[model samples]
Target: MSLLAHGNSILEVEVTNISTHGVWLFAHGEELFMSYDDFPWFREVAVKSIVNVEEQSPDHFYWPDLDVDLTREIIKHPERFPLKSKSR
Candidate 1:
């Protein structure tokens, strides 16, 4: 089924696989693995947390449940953005 058919924006996060760690999403052409280590919100979430995943375009993914969104470019190239607070 298509991700757009899921209805919920956050629930649209496609669930490829579920394990004790977290869920895997297949967005665009790359496979994004969201682990609880980085995303603590999903650490204890049930399997139903991820409703569906829709491809807004060729590089964007919409999650209707948690209102979490991401882009393919960012997942593929996270190093481009430094991990530092903007206050500095």
Candidate 2:
């Protein structure tokens, strides 16, 4: 037997993995990595907070628990946007 998906369509964005080095995000059929060195906002957060992610729009993600927002481009190319704030 096979289970069928039901209800409204789910957003295709999520935190796939969190490692000692960084976090991995899967969005819109693409896997993106955000190193702690670059994206420090997630470095010291709780696991529960990190997993609570939402896709506000195409390629845009928001973490209500952490109040952090990011896009696919930012995750893929941190060097392009070089303004870092100390992670609390």
Candidate 3:
């Protein structure tokens, strides 16, 4: 499925792979791995829970399911947000 943002702006995220553990999202010409271990809300849930993802801008992503959002900069440089934890 496709993801749309405010003003119907289309996000570039794509589901490259899905398994019982989690989903792999491809965006911004890069591959991002997300696991249920860290994102507990997605555990045992279907892929449809993704609902939608909004780019919002060039670097941010908004996920309606987990009620969570993030940005490319943060994913690329997670050290900046030391308080945050990555999936094990």
For this target, which candidate reaches the highest lDDT against the unseen true structure?
Answer: 2
True-vs-predicted CA distance for residue 38, candidate 1, Å: 2.1
lDDT of 1 by residue, 6-63 (tens): 5754333356887887667865455687665544545554556564555676668665
In model 1, where do residues sit more than 4 Å from their true spots? 1-13, 77-88
Collision count for each candidate, in order: 12, 0, 0
lDDT of 3 by residue, 1-88 (tens): 3555675855477667777876666887888766655454545555666645666666677777756677776555655655543432
List the candidate 3 regions with Cα displacement exceeding 4 Å: 1-11, 73-88
Alpha-carbon error at 74 in model 3, in Å? 4.3
Q: Candidates sorted by TM-score, descending order?
A: 2, 3, 1
TM-score of each: 0.58, 0.87, 0.60
Candidate 1: Cα lDDT at 22 = 61
Write down the lDDT of every candidate, Cα atoms only: 0.57, 0.85, 0.63
Q: Model 3 lDDT vs. the true structure?
A: 0.63
- Residue 80 of model 2: what lDDT? 99
Q: Give the TM-score of candidate 2.
A: 0.87
Residue pairs clashing in model 3 are: none
Full-model lDDT, candidate 1:
0.57
